[model samples]
Target: MENYNKLKSLVASIEADADKFFNNGNSAAGTRVRKGLQDIKTLAQEIRNEVTSKKNDEKK
Candidate 1:
């Protein structure tokens, strides 16, 4: 749950950079957005693994 909240916050934090990169023409913001996306991907994978682990545990 904590990590889920962190994921949401992380996305929220990246929103401004995403907007600047997409709606405007900010190269630096684009770089930040890309880095944020990579972080999001890694976090999402962690969340996936956690969910899978919890589910398997419940099966016992």
Candidate 2:
């Protein structure tokens, strides 16, 4: 639960940072922000998978 919450917060922060970079018109910074956003997205997916697996295990 804690891990999931942390990942969610991280995703939110990355999204906000990306928006800032995008609005500032820094192409290089925007690229970095995109990369960070992708990483956060992957982390979020992993967290979701872990949560789903845990729930499945509990059901079994």
Candidate 3:
């Protein structure tokens, strides 16, 4: 649940930066958005692996 909240927060931040970059051509904001997106990808994979492990544990 904590991780879920963190993921949501990162997505919100990325959305803000993306809007700034798209609407005003801000390179710095674009960089931040890209970084946030990469974080999301990493955290998402961690969560996925955790869930998969839990499922496997239940099966075993």
Q: Please tell me which predicted candidate would have the highest lDDT against the true structure.
A: 1
Ranking by TM-score: 1, 3, 2
Worst 10 residues of 3 by lDDT: 1-10
Superposed by TM-score, candidate 3 places the C-alpha of residue 7 at a distance from the truth, in angstroms, of 1.0
lDDT, candidate 3, 1-60, per-residue tens: 677788898898788889999999999999998899999999998888888998999998
> In model 3, which regions exceed 4 Å deviation?
none
User: Whole-model Cα lDDT per candidate?
Assistant: 0.96, 0.77, 0.90
Report the candidate with higher TM-score, 1 versus 3.
1
Steric clashes per prediction: 0, 0, 0
**What TM-score does model 3 achieve against the real structure?**
0.89
Residues 1-60 of candidate 1 have per-residue lDDT tens digits of 988999999999999999999999999999999999999999999999999999999999
- The true-versus-predicted C-alpha distance at residue 39 of model 1, in Å, is 0.4
Top candidate (TM-score): 1
Model 2 quality (TM-score): 0.68
Off by over 4 Å in 1: none
For lDDT, candidate 1 versus 3, the one ahead is: 1
